[model samples]
Target: MLQSLQSVAFAEISLAGDLISANRGFYVLLQLAPDSVVDHVGPYINNPSFTELAAGAQRAMPGQVVYQGLITFLGELGEPRSLLARVCRQGDHLAMIAEHDVRENENLLAAVMDLNEELAEQQRALARANRQLAAEKAEQQRLLQELATAQAHLVQSAQLVSLGQLAAGVAHEINNPISFVRANVATLGGYVGDLLAIIDAYAAGEALLAQDPSLLARIHRLRERCDLDFVRGDAVAVVAESAAGIARVARIVSDLKNFARINESEWQVADLHACLESTLNVASHELRGSAEVVRQYGPLPALHCCPGQLNQVFMNLLLNAIQSLEGAGNGPGRIFLRTGRQDDQGWIEIEDNGRGIGPERLPRIFEPFYTTRAIGAGTGLGLSSAWGIINAHGGRIEVRTEVGKGSTFRIWLPLSRTTSE
Candidate 1:
């Protein structure tokens, strides 16, 4: 039975550590020939050899087994193996049992540890990849938002260009008739003045006709039916009023032409004050009752810029100011337009005395489609468009505001196109 056992090795030794006998399994496990005569087990038992086993056996109580959990053993060829072993004292000898199956369990545990390390590394790499993916997603979203804003700007610019062309055509068509009407009205006023002089002379000659009573009576009846005195005074006033009205129409046409300079698409030297005045005139109806515009213009050199574009910017700022005031209760509102030249730049400032923008909404005022106004009340692109136009001109817009007070938007433009570029 002892020789037939293949995994458990049994041995018996002297209490003085001499090898007495051993199973055939012990010789086979240690790689020794079956007929080999081993003098001692010291060479085969690498760790906890025969000497250490003997001492451990002596320390134990009588017939008690001491288990050495795992011990390294060497073969005759110096190969190493591990065994779970136990030793016991019996009579004048020691009995030992060692199991070769413990080595398989140790190898399995080592493999499990290596797998755990690889799994941990893979988890760390997945976490880093997730972080990178998150960053890329955020960047993509930002880029998409920018693209949407750019498209909106392009659409708005196209609409403005079309509107400007229409305004220019309309102004041109009105200018021709208005010019002839103005000249004819002036001529009519002169003819009316000459006719009034002749009527006065006829009135003076009527005294001579008083000598003929019947003729005088007839003349007096004609004068009474005609109301000649009132006619003489009212005709001159009516003609003058017509002339004035025609002149006003002509001025409006001129202002409209100036405001929508479709022909002046390219950069050119333009008066900043003139541009502002033309814009104000074009938007006069919007300001008529909503607010009062006060101009505080200073001396400034002509600027190199697209006048139509600048006029559009001015119109936006002015309209914004007017709306701000209109929203502020029933009190009369004031819009102050100020201009000046500082260093190499000329600046135009539009200020209003109305309820101003809150700090929470101030920073994003120039962001596309961002607004504090109620839905449908505003498209929210006016300020942003103005900002874009100024930036394209190598200029900037500065805003100053207080919660309940008002806001001021100052536009700074370079004096020369070369410098601005």
Candidate 2:
């Protein structure tokens, strides 16, 4: 125990509160005592404070060991000296070891204290660096998550924007034909009523027929007003075209309602034939101006799918085919839409004779934001969304195209095992 204590920084204290003794290490370090041999006292060492302090210590302490730390004075080195001493302890016996050897112990102790201070500083610096690294890691994770979320939202927004522009353009083209047809129907209704009244007078009796030239005159007047000569060639063609036009308008409105239906609870298994027809009806206005549509239908099974969303897929495919044609330029432009079911596989192909995409562009056609169209023309989400929907239904899509030829998009839906669910 004593050696372990000695191995600590060398220190010695007197048995009481006065400067009876100090270690040589302490002596060289701070001159707590004037003489070098203080740790081991020589003969004739004397001081009343030491004696009194020892006596007081024994009295105060009773049977315990009496070492009390205190301040005392040592003789000064210079002439006309300043009295000097530092706080130290007094001991009981005045004389002990004979020599002062403190320089090495003092130097080692000072060096150890300095090293301790340096170690403490290093520990604090390491802790600060660890905290900073943790904070940076957390910040990086947060930014990565935000980036993923923002990118997903951007994809959805871009898709909706493209759909909006397509809807606006298609609606405009359809309205013009409907407006003319509606007006012609109202005019024909009036002309038919006049002809019916004139026929009633001619059949009334000879007297009524011969009453005056008024009936004949009235007939002539009606014919003049109705433009009989123009109607001779135009009326039949106009009425036939108008009937077809009104039906087209009604069909488009129905397709729009079915395609954009938000009331999902009303969903049911819809026949592919009906769905295809309605989709073509709604899209005809966009396609009519640029491409002729031909349908080749083989027997197909009804799909138990989200009607509105599946219609959206059709709309996307049909529009994409049309856009490809427009890019090619008008000429022998045609879109062939065919549907079939065979060997438990359902298939659809939308083929167009238009400017074809290159081999490099084809692979990325279904990727979001991939487009060959000019800016403001495409968001490139059409095929991607269609792809997603088809895949969700346990299906897949295939594309075939070559330069200056055209592209054919084929969609295949397999028989789902998960029964209508």
Best prediction by lDDT = 1
In model 2, residue pairs whose N, Cα or C atoms come closer than 3 Å (at least 3 residues apart or on different chains), thus clashing, are 14-90, 15-90, 15-91, 16-90, 70-88
lDDT of 1 at 23: 71
- Residue clash pairs of candidate 1: none
RMSD of each: 17.9, 17.9
Off by over 4 Å in 1: 1-140, 208-226, 329-331, 418-421
lDDT tens readout by residue for model 1, 178-263: 88888888898899899989878888898788889998899889888999888888988998899888888778888888877733
Q: Which stretches of candidate 2 lie over 4 Å from their true place?
A: 1-191, 199-244, 262-267, 327-331, 417-421
Candidate of highest TM-score:
1
